[model samples]
Target chain A: MSTAVDTSAAVPLPAEGDGTPLKKRLRRAERRRNLLFGALILPLALVVLVAFIWPIGSLLTIGVDNPEIHDNLPRTLAVLEDWNGSAPPDEAAFRALADELAAAKGSPAIAAIAKRLNRENAGYRSLVMKTARKLPLDAAVPAREALVAIDAQWGELATWQAIHRAGGALTPFYLLAAIDRAIDADGDIVAAPEDERIYVDVLLRTFWMSLIVTVCCLALGFPVAYLMASLSTRHSNMLMIFVLLPFWTSVLVRVAAWIVLLQNEGLVNRLLMWLGLTDSPLQLLFNRFGVYVAMVHILLPFMVLPLYSVMKGISPVYMRAALSLGCPPFRSFWKIYFPQTLPGIGAGGLLVFIMCMGYYITPALLGGPKEQMLSYFIAFYTNQTINWGMAAALSAVLLAATLLLYMVYARYLGPTRVKYMKAR
Target chain B: MLQPYASPVERAWYFGMRGLVGLILAFLFLPILVIVPLSFNADSFLMYPMSGFSLRWYEEFATSPAWRQALMNSLIVSPLATLLAMVLGTLASIGLVRADFPGKALLTAVLISPMVVPVVVIGVAMYIFFAPLGLTGSYTGLVLAHAILGVPFVVTTVTATLQGFDFNLVRAASSLGANPVTTFFRVTLPMVAPGIISGGLFAFATSFDEVVVTLFLASPEQATLPRQMFAGIRENISPTIAAVATILIVLSTLMLMTLEWLRRRAERMRGARR
Candidate 1:
């Protein structure tokens, strides 16, 4: 570096005739500054790429990733390629299946195949496991007869269709299943059975719950935000602490607080019973009501923060002008005041709605089995069930929704508005 | 304040609005207030009407190995993650402010994506990506994941501070006898110190309160305080969790107070300069 600087100085001294030496040095310094800037950003850029972007991209690919069957049962997959789904697998396919299963014995690959196939059909796991156990690779009997004798499912065309569908290097199984739709026997997308149609309802429930929470926040937050905006700075700052206190509180602690207050014999019920509002202790926790109460409580600050900022900016002269012109107070408020606050409404409503959609801990603690949202299932698949494909598919849906909302926010309300809201 | 030219109905509406706002504020603050007393309940149950006041729950939290380990892990992780976030985020913010390069918006968006993207998605993705490299359940993986999450806060705070900063001071220092590093330390660092410290506080809070990524990434040994609270709440509603929650509430209150103080200091410094 010192040698380069010295050389540059040497060359620039001679080039003083063509340009000023100071100009040349300044140009070199600017170039070096840009290079330093790039160098400074490189570590963070690489970290985001490796730790944030790449993982999310790869996780989204899990929906279409069907390497389990494709990589495991290669011989069977190849042989079954020629055999159409119209009939049971031919003898050659059976022999290929037997070879692959025998080869995959005492290995994790067979279990992978079984798990993949079982996702398509319930009994396919036992069928494959049983068939592999009964028929050895070196069995003298014909492959078709041995497999059919070992399990009747081997003779069914649906079983072959499922295996064929699961055979490809990439499949839409998980993405379809995530929305409670699936490829049927004829390889057509169809709605899953009533019992199997869970994810769609859960997704809808997630949206519905978020919408309710957003509306609740708006209804409850608007007046408070207005009050804060209208109050003296000293009084407003005192009130702002109340709002920011909960905002800064740990989410788990807040959820725990709700549980302590809303349980059967908890404070809320006790108060209600004492006030003669109810004869019996109300069931509040682990229900939809509990979920709503806790979610709205947790999310109200989010709504109020943006609304307060926007309200603080709104001028009172417009309302006074409308009132002087004999417009009713309510009408002036509805027409002049509310229209200007739409940006804040849009910002806070979208922010809260998107946040509510991705909420896991609050809903999981307060909501019951039927009240759980898409995030709950995402966690369930990732942790408890270890179903990466479904987890990824659900996460993709959530990411798409969040990004879409973010884009809308960026386009209309501006990203800085959201940033300021967060920082405040 | 209401206008003097008002009807009786308008007066009624003003009082009603005040009442409603008061109720909403109560709704926001009540739940947080309720937990402080419950944490000292002598009985294990978290119901209303405490059997007796006792420090047993706090004692349990202090004595129990699980709780202590979670607290220790959180202390270790939050500070390291905060430091990493401060360095990377501050550097990136400086580069962003100084250089007018193409795709700068895209780079900024990518840096902030961890903050906006659903935590569940990030957790699942990080788990899958790290699992193959055997990074899951390890402190290195958790810290890296957390540092990524912490970057956006640091970037935002520092950038906000930089918006009011004068870059000519940097040029003035360089044109004088100072090198870039010395100029940065002597001139720029003092101005941005409040921002850096507040950003670090934000990073610390994020890492401390974070549970979703920790759930997906941390093993039993690496269970963070929030993760432990989540388990305790899920498995059993114990007063120990209430005690932990109380401690966290106090910690966050302190952090929030510090952040507020920093903001005021920054404002005063800016005001003094003006």
Candidate 2:
């Protein structure tokens, strides 16, 4: 290779840094750097494209695509296309509806279609199933009479319209459920049942818990991180073991530990009783209190790491200079030292808050049923009820909230956060 | 210890606050400390009054089929997922930190989004996404889901490590006739090994602990340890759970120790190499 390169050389080399050829080499090096950088980023971009973007796109489509409605009742839908949202249709539409319903009655499509339509109306399954048993003939009977002949419930026209409205590929069922509103029999948005109308509250609670956890972690972490930054690197490294130990521990173990410690006959109660602080054991487990304790413990490191990184970068000279300029020690520390650490505080806060919002396990295990977060319901709809539509909608809301907070952080706090990088 | 920095009035406040925070840190570790001793119980029930220190629970955990299976499942899934996460995440971290590209911030956010998004959401998403692909309840599905969750940790750690990286080293390598691939292997991966390893351990521990997503994505035949523990916890409270937990605590402690040592070694190595 060396011989070939030497033979191919067009001209003799001059001293380094003196030749115009250096510029060409520099350009080639620059191009190589660019290529390497591009090559490195391309794989990651592709991973994100497949992993995050594709799944989210498919998830969002669940809120609209009513495949069950489209697939199971093609003839009925096509015949009723000209029904014009008036009375349920003439005899031809009724006959088509009877035929489709009769065909789907015993098949998997009926159950699946029933499940989809039930999101619109809970009684749709029974109405469709009952109407299927009797296939009314096309005899020009009055609209009300024709429906009555098939099933008395169909005379109301609302159930028929639900099936009719859902005939289109897109449906508003999931989005409506997301807002705690569902389409009424008459096609109006109304509040869901009292028991089921809990998404709004769950969303609110998720926000509130996240906010509280962020505040708690920030309050606790700021001081510790500051101490770490101010101390010798030796001391800081030693202290970091405490932060990293929990990081290495399984979250499940941490929560389980909380369960044991917070129970009625747990260590805390034993200690309290031994100390004569309380005669009785406290009901500390399975509540918001437990949720907070475990969550704060688990998330404490998230808050501390960012703050430590930021604080480590700040020069102590600022505080010393302030003190030399006739400022009080405490005032200098507060005014100069604390202000610079704000970037860390904001970054840590945003990170902690965003993490807390998505908490599921600690809250699920330690929290009461009422204390469950939005993630709980999202899971329930997905696993128990198999309602993918509502799950997608709820997930969308969570995503939106997360994105909004991220936007706020990026727009407002991003620039100040640069101080978090240690100065070389 | 905190009082020297305090004023007359602030002295008492500092004492109380420092005492409280110290107590809180102790409290944070108390559960782990408590369980270690409990694992030596002679009796089957988990109670305060120790019947006598014995290794019976440990023996039971080691002997029970369910417990053994759960442990095996955890052992199998966590390391695999961790390795996958380390590879993808380190690659991603290098890309994210070293490369300047449009939508880099969004890309970073997307990479880390799995960390904050509810595991249940991930579970549900995987369930719906993987069901059609026939991946539900398989080792591959669970590992993929866990790797997705674990990637963010590796990326975060490696990115943090890379922030302190010297680009001049890469330039030096290139000037010495090393190709980009050679430079990355020689100069970059070695530098970030500690962060990568720590991130991998965190990723493994993360998957080991995760239950909700496992419950949704994994089948009964493929139940991971945490999923098994979850079933046991929900169905009945047993000393077996405590034993299982204690074993995990021990394993995690070992991993933590190794991580600490590796990190310290990496720091020293970096200093020496520089």
Candidate 3:
């Protein structure tokens, strides 16, 4: 193909009287086409940049954003600027804190500052709130003495250190907290308390659950894909509807179906009782079991579709040839057929795994608190706790994992795998 | 079919494989099918031994203000989002196919990133981004977010259709004294209409069924059907959700059938031209 193109280029076209001018006109026309195409794509490119890329980029930056502390406590931060780590902050720092608290009393910024401080030390929220509430603005005594009287926590070295650490415009607090590590009182990174060490476990659980779901999907999807591929085209087409039907159905409805089926009095439990399998209904819903069931059901088609597409392309001739050479059927199938389907398996497995890692609704509705994945925590922080920084940090982690998997898929299996999935 | 030269053991293996496949298919279909019958049950509880068949849950769904409002919201949002997605996605796809440009691959990746990114991530990011702009809990916000999610589908379907399109037809029309706009309307649009319509259908369905974003961004007034159902399932499992699910399932089945029909027609048209 390259030689043919080269020869054609070398031969050149039959020249007219004004060949150079005509060539220039062709080049201009090519440029015009390029410009038109760029013009057409401009709207979509802008929309994606504004709506998708910009928002995500901003959200990820929240991981290091620490404006609430620095903005609200400028005076306190300034007074503590010269304090060393040898002991508690001086009277001047406490005096600055009391004055800032009095000046900013009843302000929303104070509350925001309190929330930020609370994330660093467990009881600092109440301390800040209490100090700001009872600050003696009209007292004759020093502002430091008034603040210390209001709350002795103001005299603690650790409290001053937390405020000092949060003084920076950009802090690693949220990101560190996301991985279940935090800055200790002496400015060293250490593991969070035993009970607070939940994010790492949740992240691990997210990976483990996604892995299990992917494996389950593969186990259940392989035979079905094989059957679809080996069957007559007419039969395969009929069977394909079953796969496509669920694929087209809303994921929520499918999850709702699982809820109904797996509930204590629902179909699965009732069937178990009817068959004399157990004395009581099992604790199926609101647990890992329920999460696995629903996620596997929802993601099975993602696995099967790719596997079937790849399997469909594999000819039966190779397996037959191996069997005709006196190779046993199972051995021939394993060595000859399975190797040909690896691309499909890789595509499907990666797709399912990535999807399961980020799943929220099914697990949220069906799983217990402990069974929830990292996405659930991200939502929890975003909606319930109203912790945007923590939410963004968690999201950054999820986004990283997803992008890494996508990069691998694009690099190895090629972008066609993604395009093929979309086509289905 | 199994070869005649195969041993009995091989035949048994084939039968076993078929049996396993059949069971797996059953597993896939059973849960979805169960909801259909359970939706009609007179009892409110999702349990066995139906008391009798009635449409009480369906009636409740229709009469309840929340469910009705949610349905209305979904009806309002999906079409608007679908229209926006169709316009943007179709134009982008046409340009992508017609011209070669630097960073085209990167641009395609970015446009399709919404589909690949986790909905939770998108939801949180949009929530934070929209809060200050006052887009959260508004119709415009939901429509825009849903449109972004839907664009990739439209782009994919339209690009596929255009791949088989002959650009010479447009040139032929222009050479024959027709304007470019007229050539597009009279020639190009007719050929790609199926893809556009089906892509629109997908966009509409995606918006209609989306929940996580709605949960984060929608106000009480803008709550969509899936959002309402999610609340229902989370707070309480009732037959009303079943009725809603049943309706949605039937609606999706119809959409799937329409898409399949469109695909077959498109194939036949392409074949005839060949």
Candidate 4:
């Protein structure tokens, strides 16, 4: 703001600076205006950069973060740095482990290191805890035999291997495991054991479930959008409330409503029983079928809105001319109308698919545990297990997939249309 | 999409497509409307074949301390978050529209990234990021998180409004010896007020409906209505949640109507000027 800005006289006055030339003052004024606007933008820009983007960038790196072991067990890892993977390190490495565990015995770092090692090999938590609990070994006695005397696991090759594997300042453990792979005791990457090989399947299932929902949305949304676009503005506006109402409604409310409607004794089952479609109330809720129904219902509007806009922009003249030239109706519709709506289909499908890949609440509520998506697992790790690294690893994958799909959608819709107004 | 010609197949197809569209529309409306009656059901179970009509569920929502607290939390958090989002979003959008910069596209993408990023990712990110700062489970954290989520909508809407704005008016006022601040207050704000209000409404609705982040961030003491409803849906499907959903449905309807009215009024104003 300038001192001259307070004036509201009818006639224009000279520029503010007295000595300087008018041209230079005008240039200075332009610079000041630029600075003012930049100042106006700075607060929100700084807030987003610090509070949003930086945090997310740091979080994604947490997938590979290995601070716990690196900070806590620095001596043991340093001793083992020169050792080969096939066999255990010698007495000095054992001495370092003993000293480090003794120092970190009662601190939270021991528990953290123990947790980190336990991921390398099961039962290592209790081994490390027991050794840490009985630490500060006698200097006269050899560290190897003394540790072996404390816990028989210290004599085993696997214990040393687990310690060696977890000693890195930054490890690919969580990120690798997110895709159902892990480093073996011998420091070779291998497929996770059959029982632990769940995340890859989970990732695939997330994609598969998202694909099914996207296809279902297109199938259901196509006719609705077509009709809505084809209708008069008055009728279309009335129909719009149907789409927008559910669109604006909270996902939780819709989930609750779907549960009330699809539960065993609920309306869908009751109607099915009354109509003799089934002999009994079907197992609807907490099943894949219910998840599909609810997800399609919730996501139908996303598909419809974009498709409706695209279809509305398509003139009827093209199809009419094709038909007027003696082309069959179905052929004309397929060759002309369908091709024109391809961009809409791509945009809506990508948008819906991207959304479905990250869906948590609906599937967690309506579907069984087996049917939950990647987001469900991310939440499970964060809330139930408090495994931030694992959660972040899963998040990194989902975030990448989501951003990649968004880029594709943006390519289809262009930059300005990237604004998705779907309520969180 | 029908022709007045000549075959049973075409007629069947015409009726079939229309009927399919009708059923799809009904499908969209059914889940939303079905819960309204259950909110008033006297029975404990959330099922069909209502036993009786009663306002007990609504009464429960009105009286239960948890429900009351959640409603209060929603009412308090959303408006504050909306106000913050509106102010910051209005300022950033004005700056964006008024200035030219080399990194403008990058800045916009960064700003709008919150919308495209999944809520679960944002929720987890907020949890981990806020926990050490003692912001998780606090009102300040929740409000900031929600305000961030709302900024993109405000930017998009305000930017749209500013697109049709006449810059010559500002120049005219300034040349008449009015200061920039006076010109802005006397000319620009009144014109863009509608866009700000609509965007603020969106921000409010978003914060009111948000639950995923709250589940990670909010304590029981800070639970909003959607968080409470999520817990109800997870633990048990009860009539009380139905009542809450009904109220939320009504609220969303009112919001939609307001947005529609705003859209029409903006259109009418522009039409009048034209």
Candidate 5:
């Protein structure tokens, strides 16, 4: 390098070999590379746009998308616009609703509209369905009285209020209901009825459970991760297999294992009973304890890996220096060593917490009614109940929480090189 | 980890932490390893004190038509999904790492968002999105959804591998009258093959273990092993599930071993090259 520098100093600078300048040539090369990269990326970008981003981006909107009543009863919504919510709609409005219902009768559209309205008022499903069944009311008889005759709910302002609330193409009914809030007759958000207000509690419970799990994982994982970090590479690699093995194993398998071990007649309870720890088998399965155990066990690796990497990077010099400076071993260890591992703590804790927020099968299989988290309800609404709006709303909440934590992760903890990642 | 000058309390703490770490490591294996012995129990029940060590559950897993179907479906779907993910992910990774652009971080985030997004959300969203396109309840949609989940792993692994890539070699190849395509095929692909394969392995493992998306996107005919196990756990705690879980545990251990070995080999290759 010194010889090259001496020759360059002795000789004058050379001109560009080609017509183009070096900077321009570099710029052109970069631009070509960019074009090639852009072309290469197009396929994956398309796949992500079509299969990943677009679906999730649009699915979140379904939470506030209120199209059922708007599509099925368009004329009714138009007619109900001028009328106040103080009383039932006028004759023309009822006639418009009857006409729309008759037009939508015997099709899935009516059921969808009825489902949407039923969300507004509980019994309105039967009212709308019953009215739709006896549709195309005689033009001779007044449409209002005729509809009231089919179902007394059609005569009430509350039923009309529901249809009016669901009038818009995009309404916050499902989203509001997700947080246990509802729009009332006065167009004001109100607390959902006590009997139906399960979501707010569920959301809080999801976060609370996640927090508990994160703490438990950190506590359990810190020592192991620290030990692994302090160990030689061969020993640490041996220990990592235990973490990686469970991690790669199917979640269903882990949940299944928990069931076998935690049940009354399972190994755990039997051992406890045999050891005289308790006279009876503890109610370990189908409870919060079981859920915590499984979640912590599952997520502990996520905690350990990140912390291990961070801890691995921290030199032992500081601890040694602190010890030599007349400081207590434990105190100096904490004062010197602990602070540096903060980023790892933040990374792993946030990672495990973010993962816990979206947990489904663990809580579903292990925990009973009170233990069900937000994902449980998301699945319930999506599958069993087929309430896409409710499902979408619940999903939006969970997705937001996840993205927020991820942003925090990205911002604070650096790039998200997820666990079981890294070439090593 | 210990110092000779350490105090008595420090010594106790060290030993205590070591013992605690030991227990925690054991805890990690408990749920996974506990089920293995039970899978061999002669009895149908998932209980302690096995009637006798037997292969009845394994036989049941092999013979049962549903289990057979799940195994077949898993074998079929995981590979197809892995292929799709590997192709897209490798190409994307190459582009993403080679090209400099604004918002690359954002783009990377978007690419890998599938890994972070809740599975239930992905399942529902895919259902809603695919239903309109007539993709749901079909093998195509199932494969596509699995591919989406798998893509992030491939992208991440391949990207990381590409970061340490020597671009001078590509320049050298092109200067030697090799076209860009030949340069990529001959020089670039060979170097990054380990990363691509390991990433594909990750994708395969993900697809193999996936149950939530399958629940949403698949028909009964497309039930994967995990899906069947999910049903088994929910309805009845059969020893057959234990058998299935054991096989999966073995498979995962194998994958982990392959990944670790491949990682070492890749490191060695890079080391030798550098």
Candidate 6:
């Protein structure tokens, strides 16, 4: 550190070269600043990478990575590398398959391994298990014949193709499963079973339900948000607490409270019956109506806050000015006030809709089987089935859709997104 | 002239709207209020018109080993997550606000990703990523997972607060022979303390209420309060749950009041400084 200061003393003899010494000193200082800032950024970057980025990246990979076939049978994977879906994998490949399956027979990891291959062909596990025990054959012909002999299931080239394809740690199996498709032997993708085909429909339903909920929130929240914005700061702050109080409570508690309020035998029902509005209690809980009601209730404030904040900055004089110029109150509001607040509307709607799409517990508890969202299936695949590939694939679709929505918003409503995001 | 004090039409409309809003707000608070009274129910079912009032359910919650364990688990995890979030979030917030760099906007989005991503996705991702490392179902894993979820609140609150901070004080400290570390602790940290504390409260609230990630990450021995409640809901909708709910509502309301008070104090202090 002293050397840096001493260098200035040593260089004082030169006149024309004084700028060079100063520039060198300046560069050194800049370097120190850069290093210090770099040091500060490194840990944050690492934490984000380790805790967030890496997990999502792995999730994306987990959707496709079929490590069981590759890692468990390295020898066979090496053999099948050059085979290229042309002929039956040679005797060594069959032997390797048999050896690995036999090794994985009793382990819990087998379920995961079985799940990976099952995507390609229905009931591929029995074929794989049957072939495994009859292996270590003398020649290629006998090995291939034995695989065929195992319930005549392995004779179909598609089963072997999926198994061979799954050798890589990364595969499109999960992503395909997300959309109810899987790669066949000929590399053709097809729809899953009618029962399994419901996932794509669920994905669409999730989108539509979220959209409806977002729209409902905007409609209901607009007036309240306007009142908050139009009022004095103290009144607005008090009202804002009403909006924010729910946010402080547990989402689970709020949802549960809604169940108690909205159930058939609950408060709403009892009140309706007492008022003679209905003869019998309505089927409210564990249905789509309950889902929408609770979701909108829970999400309405998210819609209001951004709109309120943006509206606060907007003056009402424009509307009054327009009204005085012969425009009616309604027209003035539509043409002047509403357009100015479009940014808030877009921001809040996007935020709420995106959030509603990924909701799990609310839908899981309140919604019927038909109303269960895509997130429900993602959890099912990940937790209940141990099917990482399918979970990853579903999440990838979700991520892609979200990113796409963000991009579209940025392109069309750039300033508003920026504003709302900045305010947050 | 027979001038009426109020026109019936106008009077009805005014009262109607105000009454509706009042009803809606009351509706929002109904179950919360109901749970409090129901916690003292002598009968077990969560039906309307309680038979009698008693403290048996509250006693059950207090005496039951499982409920006590769950409350204890929440007590342990929430504070640890909050502290971790406070340190990491405050440090990152300083860097985020102090330095202008390329990709800062992207960095902000990345930092907040945990809040936006589906907890199911996070749960599964953590499960897969940590399973290989044997961190799954461990206290450290749950702590880290909850902290990840909590960090965004800290980041958000602290960042917002820092936006209002005067940077000249830090620069002045630097000019007066204070290095970056000393300047931060001596000048900047004190200024952002309120933000950090409020952020920590939010972090604590987020973790204490968190269930999805905890569901995926925890084993039976480590089940959190929400997880326990979730299981109990599936098993039976007992009055004991109502007791727990009442307790949780009380705790949450206190937390929210504290948060509001802290916010008001912060505003007053800022106004005074100005």
Local accuracy of candidate 1 as per-residue lDDT tens digits, A1-424 = 1122222333433344556687777777667666666566889999999888999999999978999889988888888877766888678998988888888877888889888899888888888788777657546788888888787788888888888888888888888888888887777999977887888888899999999999999999889888899899889988988888888888889999998899888889989999999999988989999999998988888898899999999999999999999998889999999999998899899888888888888888898898888888998998898888889889988889889988998789875345433310
Q: Pick by TM-score: which candidate is best?
A: 4
lDDT of 4 at B225: 90
- Per-residue lDDT of model 4, residues A285-371, tens digit only: 888999999999999998998899899999999998998999999999999999999888988898889889888888988999889
Full-model lDDT, candidate 6: 0.74
Model 3, B1-274: lDDT tens digits are 7889978887998899988888999988888988888888987787767889999999999999999999999999989999999999988887888768888888888988887888899999999999999999899999999999889888888888889888777667766876666777788888888988888887887888889888888999999999999888888889898899999999989998998899889989988998
* Stretches of candidate 2 exceeding 4 Å from the true structure: A1-48, A112-124, A136-148, A152-160, A185-188, A317-337, A410-424, B1-18, B92-105, B159-189, B269-274
Q: Please compute DockQ, using alpha carbons, for every candidate against the native two-chain complex.
A: 0.56, 0.36, 0.48, 0.58, 0.51, 0.30
Q: What are the per-model C-alpha RMSD values against the true structure? A: 3.7, 5.5, 4.9, 3.3, 5.4, 5.2
TM-scores of all candidate predictions against the true structure: 0.91, 0.85, 0.90, 0.92, 0.90, 0.86
lDDT of each: 0.85, 0.74, 0.84, 0.85, 0.85, 0.74
Clashing pairs in 3: none
Interface RMSD of each: 4.1, 6.5, 5.9, 2.6, 6.5, 5.3
lDDT of 6 by residue, A1-424 (tens): 1122222323444355556686777656555544444355566667778977898898888776767767766777777787768666677776666666666766755665675576556687666555555544445456556666665655666666777777777776667767887666676787766677776788899999999999988887887777667667887787766766666666767776776677677888999999999999999988889999888877877787778878988887887799799996667889999999988898888878877878888888788898888788888988888766777888888877776776565566553323122100
Model 5 DockQ (Cα-based): 0.51
Give lDDT tens digits, candidate 6, residues B86-160.
888877776777555678888877877777677778888888888888888788999988988888778888888
What part of the reference interface contacts, as a 0 to 1 fraction, does candidate 3 reproduce?
0.64
lDDT by residue for model 5 over B15-80, one digit each (tens)? Answer: 998899889988998778888999999878898788999998899999999999999999989999
Model 1 interface RMSD, one decimal:
4.1
Clashes of each: 0, 0, 0, 0, 0, 3
Fnat by candidate, in order: 0.68, 0.33, 0.64, 0.61, 0.74, 0.23
- Please list the residue runs of candidate 3 whose C-alpha ends up more than 4 Å from where it truly belongs after superposition: A1-24, A75-102, A114-161, A416-424, B3-6
Model 4 chain A TM-score equals 0.87
The TM-score obtained for chain B by all candidates, in the order given, is 0.94, 0.88, 0.95, 0.92, 0.93, 0.90
Task: Kindly list the per-residue Cα lDDT of model 2 for residues A1-424, writing each as its tens digit.
Answer: 1111111222233356765688776665555544555565566557656765677778878866679979888987887787776675676666666667667877887787777677677777776666555544454655446667666776656766877878788877777778788777776889988887878888899988888888888888877787778778888887776776666666766776777777898888899999999999988988888888888988887788888888999987887789799998778878888888887788888867776777777787788997788888888888788778888998888777876876777676763322121100
